[model samples]
Target: MTDARVPDRIAVRGLTAHAHHGVHGFERENGQTFSVDAVLELDTAPAAAGDDLTRTVDYAELAQRLHAVLTGDPVDLLETLCQRLADVCLADPLVEAAEITVHKPEADLGVPFDDVTVTIRRERAP
Candidate 1:
């Protein structure tokens, strides 16, 4: 069996997008800014040795896909948004695992808070 210890990772941080997602009606109608951080686990040796783009995850493309998802649909919970983002990262065959975080800074929480975030980790099924 191949080693399951994926030691390499690609990180995309502070990705921001405007979208409509929340439990409130105004949130879905007006939309808000969402911040995302994605970490993908994989073996990068093949891409490094061959110096090929296809051998590794194209982060630019990944960001675009994530942006699309953020602006695509309206979800009631941040957990659902995180899951959708995780799904996009795991779509690549080279990605062994994905960690996703969705941040909502402008949420309508009555209490004062810095930010609200949801994080999730997903691994490819064996």
Candidate 2:
């Protein structure tokens, strides 16, 4: 038989946010800038042919949903944030799989760095 495991992929990058996501009190209270990157796996053949937005994943809508997730809830860890984002991406009917990453610029560790990020991947139930 031919290969049946070919995977489709879509990417949304440079998603930025400001939120209070951390363990420390200051981190929760003061908040900080956060960024996100997401990759979604879905069938694009139909959309490619029809050239219709409705036929495929909408990045704008996805970004808005991600924004809502970030600003709507408060979490204690980046791991939780990443998982939540993955859940959001997987909620779409067209999405078979998703990889999500959340980044924080001003971490509590007092290190000089651009950001700290967490990533997670998930697939829909077959």
Candidate 3:
């Protein structure tokens, strides 16, 4: 259950989007801002050596893909959204592993808090 493996990474952080994802009816109807952070584990040596965009992750496209996940579905759990986003990062063959974090800043927790976040890490099965 513990995946502490570390490797070179390409990261996209602090992406905010309004999404309709929650268990409560009010939360789904009203929607809220969700912050996401994605870390892709990959060897950047080739891209760095060649200075080729093709050899690396196109972050703009990745952002759009992640955004689509946020804006597309109405999942009831942040865990589901996190899993989907992790899969998006791992879509690239170059990515060996991924860590995805989703933060619900505007959650209806019935109390004041900074954030309620969910994080998941996935590695390609070897």
For every model shown, the clashing-pair count is 0, 0, 0
Clashing pairs in 1: none
Poorest lDDT segment (10 consecutive residues) of candidate 1: 1-10
Cα-based lDDT at residue 74, candidate 2: 89
Please write out the lDDT profile of model 3 over residues 6-116, one tens digit for every residue.
578888999999889999998889999998999999888899999998998999999999999988879999999999999998889999999999999898788889999
List, residue by residue over 81-113, the lDDT tens digit for candidate 1: 999999999999999999999999999889999
Estimate the TM-score for candidate 1.
0.94
lDDT of each: 0.94, 0.88, 0.91
Q: List the pairs of residues colliding in candidate 3.
A: none
CA lDDT of 12 in candidate 2? 87
Off by over 4 Å in 3: 1-6
Q: What is the lDDT of candidate 3?
A: 0.91
Q: Which ten residues in a row have the lowest lDDT in candidate 3?
A: 3-12
What lDDT does candidate 3 reach at residue 7? 70
